[model samples]
Target: MPVERSRRLESYNLADYDRLPQCTNRRRLAAGIATIGPAIAEPIGRRANDRLPFPPSTPVGNIVLKLHQESSGALNTITSYGDGYVAINLERHEGSIIVMPEGAVIEWPVSSFEALAPEHFEALVAAAPEVVIFGSGSRLRFPHPRLTAQLAKHRIGVETMDFGAACRTYNILMSEGRRVAAALLIEA
Candidate 1:
C-alpha cells in the first residue's frame, strides 16, 4: 500500500510539472502588456505636468469643500434641504416643488405622499425628464403604482426615498448630465 501511495504521489508531481509551462504561457498572454516605450511615457509625463495638484481655478473645488458655489453653466444646485424646504440656487423655497435639472423649479401640487395622485405626476411628464425622483416628505414612502402610471407610460423611471436622500440623489444625477426631476413633497 505504501509503495502504491508513493507511485500515486509521483504521478501527481509529474502532472503538476507538465502544467507549469502552459500556466506560464497563459499568464503571459493574460498580462497582454506591450513593452513600454518612450512614446507612451512622454505623453503621460507631459499631461501630468500640465494638470494642477488641486482642482483648476473653477467652482468645482467648492463642491468638494462643501462650499456654496455653483459650477459654471451648471443647472440649479440644491445647496440645502430639510424636512419642509429645499434651497435651490441658494434661494429657500417652501412647500412642494419640482426641480428640473435644466429647467425651472415649478411648484408641485402635492403636500404629502398621502395626497399623491396621477395628476400630481402630470407636471413631471410635461417636464419630460428621463427619471423622476419622488421625495416622500420626512420618510421613505412609496405611492400607489397607479399614481406613477403616467411616468411609466412615458418610459420614465421613478425612485422613491426620504426628503434628504432624494435631495442628495437629485444633485448627483443632475451633475452627471442626466435629465432628472425631483418631485419633493413637503408636509405642513
Candidate 2:
C-alpha cells in the first residue's frame, strides 16, 4: 500500500540538508544529530533526554519552541488544534515545548519579554509590517530599548500589553486578515 503524506512537507526547504535521508519511519533518536544538520543538531540532541512524552509518530511542522526558566516555575506547553498539553519539572522547576504546524491559528498569553531570544526578534522585524505588537506576558515592563529603537527606525509601530490581552487582540486582528505576529510567555 502507498503511504499518504501531508501538505506540511510539500514546501519544506530540504535544500539545506539535501544529504539527509528522507525516510519518515527512521527513528529520529537513533538517526542522531547527524540527520538534523549542524545548525539544529546540538540543541535537539541536548533535549533528547527530555523528549516529548507523546508517541514518536506525532506529526509536527512549523513548530514554535518557547523556553522559560523562572524562580516561581518552569513549564512547557505544546499547543495544537486548539488544545494544549503541558509538561512540567517535578522538582519545583518548569520548562515546556510546544510544537504546532506552520499556519496553525493560536492565541498565546504571555507575561514577560525575556522568554524570546534575539533571533526571534530579528525574524519578527524582518517580516516588515505596518505594526508589531508584543505581549509581554503579564508584566508591563518594556522590552530592551535597542529592539524598540530598531523597530522605530524601520517605521513600524510597536505596542506592548499584558499576555492575555495580547492574545485576544492578536486573534482578533488575525481573524480580520491583518499582518501580525506575537511573542507571548504564559505560565504553564
Candidate 3:
C-alpha cells in the first residue's frame, strides 16, 4: 500500500500585512497619486482640470475607447436551419421568410426560386437593408437581375447562397451590427 502525503496549504492572516506600504517605487507612487486627482473629482460630477502636472518619466498617449452595449436577445438572428425550415432566434418557420437584423420576421410569399418576381424583393427594399442575402432552398442559385433591380436602385448589395450558407451568413452579419436581411426559401 502507498502512503498518501498531506497537501494542505498553510494560510497566513492578511491583517498582519495591512500596515505595510503596498508600493515600493517612489516615482510610480507619485504618478499614481497625481492621476487620482481626476478620479476623485469625477465622482462629484466636476470636470477634471487638465493643468495637473504628470511625472516626466511617464509616457502618455492620446487613446480613446468607444463602447456600445447590446442585450443578447434583442436582435432577430437566424439561429438554425435545415432542408424544410429555418429558425430565427430559436423559433422555426417552415415557409419562405425574410428576416432583418433587429426586427420581426417578414413572411416572403414565394416558396421556391421559380416563384420569385420583381415584387417579391420589394419587402427587402422597404426594410432598407444595406445588404440582402438570398437563400435559394437546398442548393445555390442566382435570381434574375431584373428581380433585384429595386435593391440595386437603392445601392443595396445582394448575395446569393444555398439555404444553409445563407442562414450562417445572416447570423454573422447580424452579429456585426450590419443592416442585413435574409430572404430564405425553404423547399422541402
Model 3 residue runs over 4 Å out of place are 1-71
Tens-digit per-residue lDDT, 41-156, candidate 3? 66433344342344333443321222366655788977777769888889999999999877788888886789889999876887898999999878789999999999999999
**Candidates' lDDT values, in order?**
0.75, 0.46, 0.78
Who is ahead in TM-score, 2 or 3?
3
Ranking by lDDT: 3, 1, 2
Point out the higher-scoring one by TM-score: 1 or 2.
1
Tens digits of per-residue lDDT for model 2 on 1-188? 99998665444554635445654433543354344344444565436534453333444332333445433222222222111222122221122221121243233323235555444455556656556657554456567767567667778777787655655565556545566665544445
Candidate that would win on TM-score: 1
Worst 10 residues of 3 by lDDT: 58-67
What is candidate 3's CA lDDT for residue 166? Answer: 90
TM-score of each: 0.63, 0.38, 0.62
Return the TM-score for candidate 1, rounded to 2 decimals.
Answer: 0.63
Which pairs clash in model 1?
none
Instruction: State the lDDT at 41 in candidate 2.
Output: 42
Candidate 2, which ten residues in sequence have the lowest lDDT sum? 74-83
